[model samples]
Target: MRPLVLLDVDGVLNPIGRRPPGYRRYRCVVEGVTYVVSLDPRHGRRLLGLAEATGAELVWATTWEEHANDWIAPRIGLPSLPVVAVNADTLPVSGHGEMFKTPAVAAYAGLRPFVWFDDQVWAEDEEYLRVHQGVGDFLLVHVDPAHGLTSDHLGMAKEWLTLTGFSQGS
Candidate 1:
């Protein structure tokens, strides 16, 4: 089975603050909420390349939910991808300091190895995935809200994908 690359939009593809030069900006309204986002088109190509090299599937794990396909993907030159159902704006309600989406993400991943990219992922979230029963290998990439996803983050995911025995299969 192919591993999964879980993508977060707000802080991964779209920066929460100042972005690298030449990023395309968009004013999006989802469910009556306005969001102004900045995205580098190059990120789409890079993410696609990483998926191809690792025989992984790119899945959305953002709170943008289904709107990622409509508002986020095309802005960054990516196609619509499967989304992990996550509750938005929710704090760590489990009391273990884990993000609210942890349980849902773990369920979606099941036995598949996954690389998660998000600004919010913390050590606690990693531990939650690590200790999840019947869970597969996972890499939590903490993206900077200020800088967004970088080559360094992608490199880490690439390395971990190899370590997880990823095969570039047709």
Candidate 2:
């Protein structure tokens, strides 16, 4: 089976603060509230390219959930993908500053190899991955919340996929 690519919204595809050079600000009204989301069109294309190159399945791992398909995906030109449902109440607190989503992410990944992209993942999460999810190839990428996802990050993911020999039908 191909590896799964777990994608985050804020911090990964969307950054906070001033827009970066390649990004464009888009305003949308959801439930009568106007919100502006900064996104890079290239990111969607690059992500799609990466999935094709690596034969990984892209999935929504953000709080946005199905809303990502309703709103964000169209803006960035991405097709709808599977969503990893997470509930805050059931989140595991390790007292190690590990992200609350860590356990949920791991559960969603199950025994499948996956690449996780998020801004809040920390050392504790890494430790958990090492101890628990170490049986298979997994890459956790921390994207800067202020900058969002970049070409360099994408390249690194591609390189890791290549280095790990995780190709199509693997």
Task: Give the runs in model 2 whose Cα sits over 4 Å from its true position.
Answer: 30-33, 133-135
Candidate achieving the largest TM-score: 1
Error of 2 at 126 (Å): 1.0
Q: On residues 1-170, what C-alpha lDDT tens digit does candidate 2 reach at each position?
A: 67888899888888988889988888867668777889898878989999999898999998777888888898888999999886567667777667888877877887778888999888888888777643366888999999999888888888888778775723
Model 1 alpha-carbon miss at residue 31, Å = 1.4
With a 3 Å backbone cut-off (N, CA, C), the pairs that clash in candidate 2 are: none
Estimate, for each residue in 1-170, the C-alpha lDDT of model 1 and write its tens digit: 78999999877888777767878888999889998899898998999999998899999998889999999888777899998989846533567889888888998999898999999999999898888798898899999988889999999999889875864553
Per-residue lDDT of 38 in model 1:
91
Candidate 1: segments with Cα more than 4 A from true spot: 89-93
Please list the C-alpha lDDT of all candidates, in the order they appear: 0.87, 0.83
Global fold similarity of model 1 (TM-score):
0.93
RMSD (CA, Å), candidate 1 to true, equals 2.0
C-alpha RMSD of each candidate structure in angstroms: 2.0, 2.1
How far does residue 168 in candidate 1 sit from its true spot (Å)? 3.6
